[model samples]
Structures are given as C-alpha cells and as structure tokens.
Target: MDWSKSKSIFIIVFLILDIFLYSLYLNRHTEAQKVEVLGEKTIEARLKDDNITYTTLPNIELAPYISGSVKHFTNEEMQAFNNHEVLIENETKIIVTLDQPVPITDVEDPASYVDFLQTYIIDGTSYGLWEIDKTNQSATFFQRINNRTIYYNNHGMVKVYWNANNEIYQYEQTLLLDLVEFEEKEELWSPIQVIQVLYSRGLLKPDSQITLVKLGYSTLVQFTQTQVFVPTWEIRVINSSGQQEEYFVNAVEGKVIDVQFDQSKVEEDEE
Candidate 1:
C-alpha cells in the first residue's frame, strides 16, 4: 500500500464532509430565526391594528360543538369567526355605553332655537320646544333632539310642548317661547292616533260585527272618518229576535258608520 496516497485521499474526503455539515447547520439556524422574527412582527402588527381600547377580557365561552367543529375549520372560516367575535364585542361595549347617563337639554321652541344651539354648542342632546310662534301664526315645534348640530328649515314638526321625563329625578316644564301664533286644531290622524282610538273604543275586535244603533252611528262613523283618512263600512246585524236592523260600521277604522233595523226579518223570525 502507498501510505502517502491513502493519507492524502482521507484528508480531502474529511474536508469535503466537514464543509457540507457546516452549510446544513447554518441554513437550519437561519430558517429557525427567520420564522421567529416573522411571527413576532405579525403579532405586533395585529395588536396595533386591532384598536381595542377596553381593558376587560371578553366573556365569550366556546361551545363544545363549536370548538370541535373549529378544529377542522378552514383558514377562511377561522378568520371569519374571529372577525365576528370582534364585531360582537365592539357592539356590546357600545350598547353598554349608550345605557350610561347622558345629559339631555330641552331648548325652548326647539324649531326656532335649535339653530342657536347648533351654532354654539359642540356636544349634548337638544330637544325641540313646542311654542306658539306669533310671527308665523302657526303652532311650531322643534325636531332635532338627538345631538343635532346642523340648522335647517322644515326639518321636523314644531315641538309645542313635552311632558316631564318620568325617569329623571327632577321635573321641569319643557317649554319654549312662542314666536308664532297657535293655529286652529287641524284634523289629522296619525297611524298611532288611529290605532289608539280604535283600541280605546273597543272596535278593533276580529271576526265579529258591532251594531251601532242611531247613537253608535252619530258617535263612531263620521267622527272617525273625519279624524282618520280611511272609509268605514256599514254592517247590518240581526239579532235572534224577529227584528231586522241595519248598521253602518267602518271595517278598518273599527267605528260604527250607520245602523238600521230589518223590521220585516224581525217579524218573520218572531213568527
């Protein structure tokens, strides 16, 4: 054997192997550190962008079924769930804050004075004041009540008056100066008013007919028509007695339109 040739070959092979191992180690270390840095940056960016100000932790508890399903969920589904959770938490916080005590101010004759408040104040709730505007010769009320800062004409009905806020500890008469004259009562039936009248008169019963005698006719029919914008139907009801009667009633408004008796039918039934 040639000792010099063998020794040279062994040295060359060992050097080659050492270089390969060193390269592998360096590559592995670089990859591991790169992943760690990327992960940390991603977390920091998320926290900054979230913009959550509350210090309290969310009270959401994962249901067993949902947790199990999430284990196999896709990336999109997971992202969507996280977004929903964030939205829900934000909404809850907003609702809680809304329930806190908010200062409310009633401006006299809000329709006229709202402009003044909007021009001067930056924040707070301003309500319309109901007052007789002598200049306009009509009952005017202000409308902008919920933190309105802009001034505009014909924004809402005249706030002529408001009852006391029952919830508040102190009671105050919310009044505004009357710059305009009060107009004569105009006959207009709002939806709520119409419903209230029907309910109060016991005319809104379903699947039944109410017969208004002459008394019912005068009280229910024309008055309801003039008040509400709907027509009334006149229905004639015959009792078990041998007497026929006719009645006029408003079907929709639940008011008695007219009532008359079928005298012939009543006689026949009696026979």
Candidate 2:
C-alpha cells in the first residue's frame, strides 16, 4: 500500500540523526585540539610601578631552636628505604628513585606528597609543610616553630623532585630533628613593606617587575652544629633585561639575606 513512502521517510530520518552526531563529534574534536595546542602555561606577573619610601625597621633577634643538640645517625638509619630503591649518605640526607616501572602523575598537593615522603623516603624524623612549587614539581618542607614556619632551603629542609615522566625520581631531606619553640611570637613584616626597603636601598630597580613575594625561612646558619634560622620574605623581581633576581628580607630583623648566603649554604650541603 504505502511501503515506498515509508522507506523514503526512514532514510530521511536516519540521515538527519547522522548529521547531528557528526556535529557533536566535530565540536569535541575542536576542543581537544585547542587544549593540546595551548598546553599548560604559567601566569605572567609584574612589579608595582609606584613611588615608595623605605624606612629602617627596628631589629628583633631570635634565639636558636634546639641549640647545640645535634642528633647523629648513620645513613642507613636515616633514609626510609622500605623496599624502595634509595641511597642514603648521612643522617640528614636521602635520595630515592621511582621503584615502579610505570608512569606516575605529578603530585599537586603538598600534604599528600609529604605523606608519601614520610612513608617511603624519610625515616625516624618528622617535618613541617611549607610550600609546593608545581612548575618544577618540587616540594619544599620547613621547620615549624612557635606557629611560625622557618625555611632553611638547604640546611634544615627537605626538598622532593619529580621528573618529567612524573616519577618521584629524587628528593633531598635535611631537617632539624630537635626544634625548640621561641619564648615569644615573631613579628613578621608585610611583603609591601619589605619591597619598599629593597627599592630604597637600590636593590630593586624602578623599572624592575616583581614576579613573586614569598615568605619562608632563609638558609640555615652554616657549619654550626647548632644552627639557627630566621623568617624571610623573598622578592622575585624580573629586570627589564628579563633576568630574574631573588631578594630576601629578614622578616623579623628587616635586612636582606642576599644570594651569596644561599649559595654558600647550598654548596655546603652534601645531599
């Protein structure tokens, strides 16, 4: 009766459905291509272009934490090598490599990374969380004292490194096992105030741009068995030449730590 009419109608409906599906596939493909091309990018930053006056800050001294009480341990006792491929050379040093023969994802959260470190990389010692720099997939831990975080980049801290393959390839740990709290709370200076001090001292150029204003502990006192650490604000400024320079201000004492101080400390660390 109407068989020919029915066949034509069916073919037309299927054609419309196929076109709709093709449109959806194309949209998804375009989005995927965009993400692939853009990749992961960092946020650009610049320094403030404003007039400022720097005033000297009164210095406040801090007593050393756990002065003269250095705990000694063999390399074997220090590194937590529980079925993990690792190398330990001293009490305050550890290096571990990825044991699994598979891809590992870059760890974003600092808390979770610390836990992994504690279980697989560290042994018999606990640490305080400071910050995680995701660009390099590196995690830096500090010594928590009296509610203030002290970041001794080389002398008394643990830094973990992840490779491009997202594998936990290497990590360096040097922590103060015995940290005593200060009697009084520390008075920290704001980043803006520190920036002004740097500008007035001719340390920061007027045309220089600041990339980051971070607060952490400066490198530890070198060669002192009983080393002390101070709270510091780090100003990362990019010059007009596109060179990045890091300026450290003693948060409590109001002075610059300088790059030489850090370089010397890092050179001294065996790990």
Best by lDDT: 2
lDDT of 2 by residue, 1-271 (tens): 2578645654554455356336545654342232212124211121333422222333433332222123444655635455556665555455556566323354675545644655653431355665677797787765555444454445455777777766666676655545554344455655665665565456676566677776556543433344445566666777767797777766654556654423423211111
lDDT of 1 by residue, 1-271 (tens): 3578645654554455356336545554442232223244443243344331112222212110000000111334324322222111211111011112223353333344454334322221333443443443333333232222111122122222222431111111111111121122212222222222332343333333224321111111111001111122223333334243443332222333322211101011111
Considering summed lDDT, which 10 consecutive residues are worst modelled in model 2? 36-45
Backbone atom clashes (below 3 Å) for every candidate: 37, 2
Best by TM-score: 2
